[model samples]
Target chain A: MAPTPLAVSIAATIASLVLLFGVLELVRRRRLREKYALLWILTAVVLLILSVWRGAVSGIATALGVSYGPTVLFAVGALFILVVLLHYSTVISALTDRTVVLAQKVASLEQRIDELERGQDSES
Target chain B: MAKRCLAIIPAFNEAGAVGDVIRAIQRERPDVDVAVIDDGSRDATAKVAREAGAIVLQLPFNLGIGGAVQTGYKYAWDNGYDIAIQVDADGQHPPSEMSKVIDPVASGEADMVIGTRFREEGGFKSSAVRRIGIAMFAWLVSTIIREKVTDTTSGFRAVNRKGIALFESDYPQDYPEVETQALAHKHGLRLMEVPVQMEERQAGESSIKLWGSFYYVVKVTLALVIGLFRKPIPLPEEGGH
Candidate 1:
């Protein structure tokens, strides 16, 4: 009743190929620098290997002292979120500073205009 | 004869202590032209400044400190003032020590003079939060401008023609110390540091609260980085010589 060996092999081959294609796309789009692209490709390969070979994952989990369940996935997801949030905070802070400075510049210009108007009025 | 000096006091809702700041600066440097930028204060700050013999530039709406200071710089640059000093509206910056920053710029020694509390006798500010923020900002400023700046965010300072031109064109609005230094360095203006004493606020709560100060530091750091890489904003309609 189990799926044939050919079907499992075909699915694994397709998933791994997709992972490699994604890594290549990131590099081609210049979203990942060449030097960093190598690291990303390596990571994708490791993930593919772990998914295809159950023995590799169990060995990794045992070595790392983590239960081979949702725990490892959850930990990785949380780390990714934390990193993304930190990056976002940095970007937002920079944007706010620019806004504040720009606003100030606008305000100063307005003040100067007002002063000039008042000067002209007084002279006339 | 001593060089002509202009002290720009940028104020916003600082009616309580701005008068005293203007009066003290006048007492110290009677020859220095004092201009009070009343940044849409919903108080008698403008009247008080005028009554104290300071030329008042009343903004129709709140432009905050950066706007007020920029207005002063533009006036100084256009009107042929030899030196322009930025004195805070709050009484935190001592008027007596105004000479520390002004004299350097006036003597042709420095294009800009930053009053460095870091170099003061007490070493550095004691506020734990402020200290951490200052250190991080100092590092960031150094990285951005590729120059060493001990106190990256001190407000009380002085500038001459070179500085006047740069800041009159692109002064930062909120928490501007670090950004100002970055801009100055970018423009190849000479910057010097002088030891000057600062006093705690004399009256009224500081507009910069604890959390606000934290946010200010974080925001300013990012602004500096982005500003360095981003294209500058075009000068506003009121830009002048």
Candidate 2:
């Protein structure tokens, strides 16, 4: 038997709410940066809206001539994940570059201090 | 006014050859201060360099050749050096040929000067495969920038204060020797190359292996292409004094 539209909507709404609350909890605990949590929250809210408004997905799917309504949800979800992953990768790459620069600065500063101390000792 | 020159030698696990390199440079140019960027070497590179009369900047971790060289540039810029030269610490670069690379920069004729091995008759010839790769890069860079470039991968280079300011802040992190030429040209800095003698490494292996060479070619080529489209980095005000 095909699952009723109401049941499908309830399940999706619950899942999206769980994701939204989980992201908030993580942000509050300082485990996830608020900047990144905002993106997760946006994704969850969009998913929640789509699940509540059953006709919205079907309407877009129909407008796009997609036969399956659920397929539209899955496709959009996959795209969001890809975008989030790419964003994180770029952020990580920038952080890695900055870390290398910081390490170099620290090393040079330490060497300078050593030279200064040595000069002082020799002079005394 | 005479420019204060600093020679920066970036070394990694090169204890055996770095000391000799430092000593040779001091002998060749007594007036020029020498500093060795010891890139997290487990060996006695720092001790050897210091004993040989080089101020050593020992990085806490290995940041590769580019990071190491940038540290030298930063030191030069911060300490009010008028000229900065990069010489590898593996003994491949001949300190006796330092004048050949430094003269153009010191004279204000060029902002940056590179020491080329191919145009010269006396330098140690590279392997055939490496030579081919170098030739290809030379051709590509010259064609793209419309400037004749004979040796794009030479690490021996001298830069004036303006060049120092540019490189100190925005040097490429890996395989920078070639791509930096494009970068220099992009920033409207004058570039020149002089023939200089080079030698085979006296001790220790090259950082790049045979397999690594292939990757190096691809990575540098891509970097050069992307670099063409990048917004030109603005020169620092007052050339970082």
Q: Score the docking of each candidate (DockQ).
A: 0.04, 0.04
Q: List the residue pairs that clash in candidate 1.
A: none
- Number of backbone-clashing residue pairs for each candidate, in the order shown: 0, 0
Which candidate number has the best TM-score?
A: 2
Encode model 1's per-residue lDDT on B196-224: one tens digit a residue: 88887666665567878756755665466
Model 2 chain B scores worst on lDDT over the 10 consecutive residues at: B232-241
lDDT of 2 at B116: 93
> Per-residue lDDT for B200 in model 1?
75
Candidate 2 residue lDDT tens string, B2-66: 77999999999999999988888889999899999999899999999999989899887788888
- Which runs of model 2 end up more than 4 angstroms from their true locations? A1-124, B239-241
Docking class of 1: incorrect
lDDT of each: 0.74, 0.86
Range of the 10 consecutive residues with the lowest summed lDDT in candidate 1 chain A: A1-10
